[model samples]
Target: MFTWNFQYISKARLSSTLKQLNLSAEQGDILIRIHTAIHLADEAVDLARFVKELVPKAVIFGTSCMAVINKGNYALNRCIISVSTFSEATVCSEVIPIMDEYTGTVLPVDMLCGQIKKEFVRDNTKLILTFFSGQYKDAGHFVDRCNDFFPSVPMTGGIASCAQNNQDDFSDDGFVFNEKGWSDRAILVAALSGDKLENLSSFATGARVIGDESEITDTFRNCILSINGKNAS
Candidate 1:
């Protein structure tokens, strides 16, 4: 088992980095997680293709990040690539499209949870990594619903984010991609299972609640309609 992290440079640099790892694409399977900044979004597809050529059997999964995080350092306009090669671990992933054109809404939380449970629940499964569109309005509710389905299994990941030059207008250009392709309105659930593989997750938030406590009185889909008996701003 081996894992390596790299900041995006160029295709040549990527080749050199992989060569330095001394990994055998022919002998062991590889899983790649790419977190890239919004400015580098256009290059992501090419990068995925390059990695595929380097390792024909590799399974690549990634999403755009508002800022790339690596080794305790945060960077914007950069990319972070994490590759894991394993000979004993079992990995599987499923992608579910979340768009609903009729209602102009994304998938409902209950339905999303049902699909994930149906596809990923297994006795040997150790952990699940989820990558969903950042444009999803109800990310918090989606996570809560996922927890309800697999309370015992650990889950971790982030929502895809894109760069927004205008603070008033948030862009919905973030995307998540895998071996199959990329999508802006989809959720990818990956499961890792095996006795040899151990999964660990940790999270940190920089925000603190300073205002008085308030209760959510009503909600419409992903929107907060009322708080403390008054209309939410």
Candidate 2:
């Protein structure tokens, strides 16, 4: 496995780094995480073309982030690309569009869960990495359904968020890209299986709890109807 960090969005620099890796595209898959500030958002199609030319058979998956976590530190406006070559392990990915009707109502939780299970449930699956559009109103419920489906398998991912600067202004909506192209309202899931790869998952939240614990008593879709003895609202 090899990971490279680029502070600036430069196709020349990216190509140079890939050349240095001395890897063949047929060997493994590539995962890329980019900050939304980078102009790569404007030239994503061209970038995908360039990567495909380099590794025609390699599966490419990428997503935009508010900030990239690198080397135990958060980096702003940076791009992190990880290339992995697994001789004995297997890797595969699938993209599912968010189910939204013309009226903008999303599919029910049970239906969404069924969609995920139909696409990703497989034998020997060890790790699942997911990336979803931050615009989805029910992203939390979607994640909970995923967790319930794959309780034994480790899963990690986040909602794509726009870039922010010191002024706190956000720009450039986030997206996810794959061999089929990119979309702003889709979920990308990658599964890795085999004995050659070891996986560990962890998460951290910036919010701190200040009040007493409350039990969620009622819910409707993604909204909580009541908590403890009072209405959630």
Instruction: Return the top candidate by TM-score.
Output: 1
lDDT for 58 in candidate 1 is 77
What tens-digit string does per-residue lDDT give for candidate 2 at 1-233? 55555553577877787788776646565554433444344455457667667767666777767677768888776666666666556777776777575765666766766776677766667788888866566777777877787677778877777666521443245777764667777787887777667777877789998799889999986689999968999
Task: Flag clash pairs in model 1.
Answer: none
Which RMSD values do the candidates have, in order? 5.7, 5.0
* lDDT tens per residue, model 1, 23-62: 7756566788888774344466677878878877777878
User: Lowest-lDDT window of 10 residues in candidate 1?
Assistant: 164-173
